[model samples]
Target: MLRHVVLFTWSDDADEERREQTLAALRRLPEEVGGMTSFAVGPDAGLREGNAHTALVADFPDVEAWRRYADDPVHLQIIADHVKPILAARSAVQYEV
Candidate 1:
């Protein structure tokens, strides 16, 4: 399987409502897009200082499935509509699990 992981840092002005909105939008992706074996996303636990604001992990059957998820219109729309406005930085990786 392939595991996709992403970390996001929010802009300084990001508020709870905006963050919640982004998370809620992301939570809908698995239903909207296909080929995901598993998916999870959430805000940081605050157990460590300087951690990214949020993280997402998704599992797919193969690179093709991951690619489909990457290019999915629903995912793109969520990023454009909910994430970009408040996003300060992002890091992501995909690897065999």
Candidate 2:
């Protein structure tokens, strides 16, 4: 299996409503993309002061499957429409499990 992880820090002006809208868009991915074995997303619990504001973890059967999800139009649309505007910084990692 392949695991895809993402951490996001929102823009200074990002508000609760925008964050929730982004989360709602993220929640729709499993149904819209193929080859996702598992997926999860949540806000940071504030246990650590400098942690990213939000995070996402997704499991795929293989790198190709991960690629499909990465390139999916629906996913791109959501990122562009809902996420990009509010994003300050983002990082990701993909590894074999």
Candidate 3:
């Protein structure tokens, strides 16, 4: 299995509405897009310096699955329609286990 990890930091002005929208979009991906074996998203309790405010943990069969997810039209729409507005910064890391 492979883990696709994503972290996001929101600006001070980004409010609950944005979070909710982001969550809704996030929650929809596994059902709407193919190739995602698993998915999770939530706030970070770690609070490490520069640690992302929100995190997504996804498990896919392989890197190709990851690419499918990354390129899915619905996913792309979420990035353009919602995430891009409220997202201050984001980071992603992928690895196999």
Candidate 4:
């Protein structure tokens, strides 16, 4: 299996409602996009600065499936619409399991 991980920071003006919506959008990814075996997210509670506010973990059967999901149109749209507005810094990592 392969794991896809993402960590994101919100803009300074981002609020609770928007964050919730962002989480909802994220939670819907596995159902909307194919090749996702599982997904999980959590709020970042560390008090340190320069920390991401949220993180996402996705499990895929293989690299090809991961690529298909990454490039899916609906997922792309969500990234452009709902995600970009609230996101500041972002980082991702993918690896075999």
Candidate 5:
């Protein structure tokens, strides 16, 4: 399997509306994109300093499937139109599992 992990830190000035919009986009991803075998996304609990504001873990059957997900138009659109506007920083990793 391929495991993809993403960490996102929202801008300090991000408001509730922007956060909700981000969530809305994420909620649509599974249905809109293909090749996602498992997915989990949520805001951080803030149990530690220097943690990102949100995290996503998605598993795919293989690297090709993961790539399909990465290149999905809906995912790209949401990242560009909604997520990027309020993002302070982002990090990600993709690896075989």
Candidate 6:
């Protein structure tokens, strides 16, 4: 399987309502798109200083599945409409699991 992890830092203007909207949209990805075996996303736990504001973890069966998820229109829309506007920085990795 392939595990995809993404960390996001939001802009200072990202308020509670916008953050919640982004989270709500992201939480719908598995249902709205295909090839995601499992998915989880949420704000950081505040356990450490300088952590990313949010994290997303998803599992897929293979590279092709991951690619489909990456290219899915719903996912793209969510990024465009919800994430990009508030995003300041992002880091991501995909690895075998």
Mark the regions of model 1 whose C-alpha exceeds 4 Å error after superposition: none
List TM-score per model, in order: 0.97, 0.96, 0.87, 0.91, 0.93, 0.97
Query: What C-alpha RMSD separates each model from the true structure?
Result: 0.7, 0.8, 1.8, 1.4, 1.0, 0.7
lDDT per residue as tens, model 3, 71-92: 9898999888878889889898
Off by over 4 Å in 6: none
For residues 1-97, what per-residue lDDT tens digits would candidate 2 score against the true structure? 9999999999989989989999988988998775788999989899988899999999999998999889999899999998899999999999988
Model 6 agreement with the true structure over 3-95: per-residue lDDT tens digits: 999999999999999999999999989889868888999999999999999999999999999999999888999999999999999999999
Q: Model 5, 21-83: lDDT tens per residue? A: 897788688888858889988888879998998888999999898988999888999899889
Per-residue error for 51 in candidate 4, Å, reads 2.7
What is the lDDT of every predicted structure here? 0.93, 0.92, 0.85, 0.89, 0.89, 0.94
- Cα lDDT, model 3, residue 73: 90
Off by over 4 Å in 5: none
lDDT of 4 by residue, 1-97 (tens): 9999999998989899999888888888878886888889778888888788999999999999999999999999989887899888999999999
**Candidate 1 lDDT tens digits, 43-82:** 9999999999999999999999999999988889999999
Task: Note the residue pairs that clash in candidate 4.
Answer: none
Rank candidates by TM-score, best first.
Answer: 6, 1, 2, 5, 4, 3
Instruction: Count residue pairs with overlapping backbones in model 1.
Output: 0
Candidate 4 weakest ten by summed lDDT: 34-43
TM-score, prediction 5: 0.93
Q: Local error of candidate 2 at 62, Å?
A: 0.4
